[model samples]
Target chain A: MLKAIWDNIKGLYSLLVGLSITGRYLVSPRKTIHYPRQVVDDEILASFRGPLELTRGRKEPGQTRCISCQMCVRACPGHCLTVIKGDAKAPSRWIYDFSLCCLCGACVEACPAGALAFSHKVYLVATSREELKLDLLADLKARTEKEAPPKNE
Target chain B: MDLSLAIFVQIIVAVLLIIGLMVGNAVVMVYMERKVAGFIQRRPGPYEVGPWGTLQAVCDSMKLLAKQVFLPGNVDFILYYLAPILAFLPVLLLFLPVPFGPILTPLHINEGIVLILAFAGLGVLSNLLAGWSSNNKYSLLGAGRAVAQTVAYEIPMILALLAVVLQSGSMDLAKIVGQQGQYPWQWNIALQPLAFFIYLVSLVGETNRAPFDLPEAESELTAGFHTEYSGMGFALFFLSEYANMLLVSFVCASFFLGGYKGPFLDGIWWTFIKAYLIMFFIVWIRWTFPRVRFDQLLNINWKWLLPLGLLNLWLTAVLVKFLV
Candidate 1:
């Protein structure tokens, strides 16, 4: 009975300890980043894989490194990719149905020419499935054009 | 035998003001609870609604007001409608006896503590009615738990306050306040610390706050008795719960913490400050502790608090008889 009493007293003391621990945390600084007002650090966002994009060729910024091998099309589990081979090794059309893409990185790994990679488009949003069907070659061209003037300077 | 026109007007005005206090207290408490919970969990809660989310509770109340009053099928319609109203109305009467300041009591009566304690039991009736009338098994279980918890805790609570009543030699709340000194050391808490401790524990149990919130244990009961209530029905329960917390805190402030008496000034502001500080402590602990098991909750009351409260009351009586 005395032991029980002592144990209960210790348990009551433990309650106070719990309160003190939480009380210390209560005045401590909050860890939330407040998303809209501030974005995440680039270091944290660096490894984020959002959607597939065509990497720029080493020789020319606007040119694709893809050689229309159809390897990525075969590698894609979701059958989300379509490549129409042009007269040259370069592809005329590279369509990526993002709605269908599982983001498995299989297509990126399968590319022999090192043409495809994941873009850090964390803010990507779409209202409909059609909006998600991306034209990768056109996206590459727009990106190259946006980068051209800055490089010339 | 005769009630004056001025007295009648004062009572009417006081009732109206008390209603406003209940609604306002509910709004403030919602924001406070969420923010404190957020801070403890290392997040910023409710920052988007207004400046530092000050108006989040207002928006939430508005949403509750606009929501469709969806009643479940085959409910006891009169009792179902009556439960929330019953839960809310008794709380207004409970505030009437609280000595907010030296001269700020709404209705000064002789058996003030008795009035408050008796009416407080009416809240449990509302819970029972809400559960039984709802035709839901979870609601019935919640109501059962509420009845048991409230009934068991009330004994220790009454014993705790009874010790203070003996110490002060009065049941009049203002008289109790008048007896205590205007400082921390001179408060009843210093003299009757065990009773104060018992009162604190029972206060949490009686209010159905966390650690003893078995009635509304979310994971187990899915909001307990008020599960079927939506829109204004749910809102009324929410308001009453906070108002109940405020009432008990006020009781604690007066009986143990020297009511409207503080070091600097003796006024209603002291009462408000003390009461809110107690309320803040309630919110703090709600975030800190997990809910106790239903059996453990009862065990704390019956085995520990009840005996401790009796011992304190007996000691206070013995000391008062011979020493004081």
Candidate 2:
């Protein structure tokens, strides 16, 4: 009975102490990020795994450095990547099914030419299932077009 | 017709109370957890949105609501669909028996204590159904662990509670509270402190809280039984969890801490304060302790708490018979 009483007293004491600490923190400022609307910027975003991105080499133009070796296709554990080898003249057609892509970056590293790079633009990827299937040729074309320097005078 | 109208009104009031308490506490607790986690980890948390991220829960809810509700192809249609609701319903119903304040007992069944335990135990069923129906091995494992933990902890919890019931000599929680009022140190905690300690520990474990949170162990189970859930399904599970936490705290306050028995102010305010204080401790424990191993969790209850609770009950009975 004495031991029971003692335990209960200690329990009550501990409960009160715990509550006091929590109560103090409750009144204190909160530490949650209101995601989407009041977006957390790059500094905090670095820690979270939101989405994947693709980056290009500074000096390489029209050169993704992806040597159509199909290593990324084989290495891609998710099987989200579809690569159609382009003629030696044409850029290799690499289709990325974002739906299947695990964002593991296996494909990015597998590119021997350093052509395939992860981008930082982690927006809502796609809505429709069909849209998530990215045409490699079209993506490359767009990237080349976007990266191409404005026509010189 | 008049009786039916009264019943309807009572139900509406009860529902409103449950929703109001659950939503309000969830919002506050979510904010509190983030801030507390941040404070413990030596960093500023959520300083940007709506004055220190007060609206963070709102934003998170909106984002989740907007997100696509994915239904995995391999999942069992009915059970998979029903899992979240099953997981959530017990938490909602568990509040029906909880006495929030002195005069503000919303839905008081005669056997409130038993009702609370029964509903609380149902939380495991939902977890199991979710894991099994999802057909995911990890989810199944999580659910299995949850069931085992629930079974292990609930025995000690009930035994501890039985000690309080033995002292009070009634199962009706309101009467138990009334009985406590007759004594000088009214709270059962003063009389049966060991039982109270056992109750607290078992309550935490029963609720799958930290140091005992094996079911949803993030590192191991990867979000546990609700791994396959998305959108509203996930939201329901989230809502139910906070509701469970609140329910546990309410019961703890009622059984041991002298329900609604404060020094000066004697009513609903005291009850709410005590209950919230209990909740704060629950959250504090969550942040403070690392999760206990599965084996350790069972052993703690069976080896230590069960025997101690039984002994405490025996001692309480003898004391009441002789001293009281």
DockQ by candidate, in order? 0.74, 0.08
**Candidate 1 chain B worst ten-residue window by lDDT:** B1-10
Best by lDDT: 1
Off by over 4 Å in 2: A1-153, B1-5, B181-184
Give lDDT for model 2: 0.77
- Candidate 2 lDDT tens digits, B1-324: 998898779878888778878888888888887877776554566667898789998998898899899988789979988988887776767777666666667666788888888878778888898889988888899999989999888988899988888777888777777666633387888888898889889988888878688988999989888899899989888888888888878888788887777787667776777778787677777876668788878877887899998899899889889987
lDDT of 1 at A99: 97
lDDT of 1: 0.94
Candidate 2 per-residue lDDT, tens place, A41-100, comes to 887656665333334444555445555678888998988877676788334666788788
Highest TM-score scorer: 1
- Minimum summed lDDT over a 10-residue window in model 2 chain B is located at B175-184
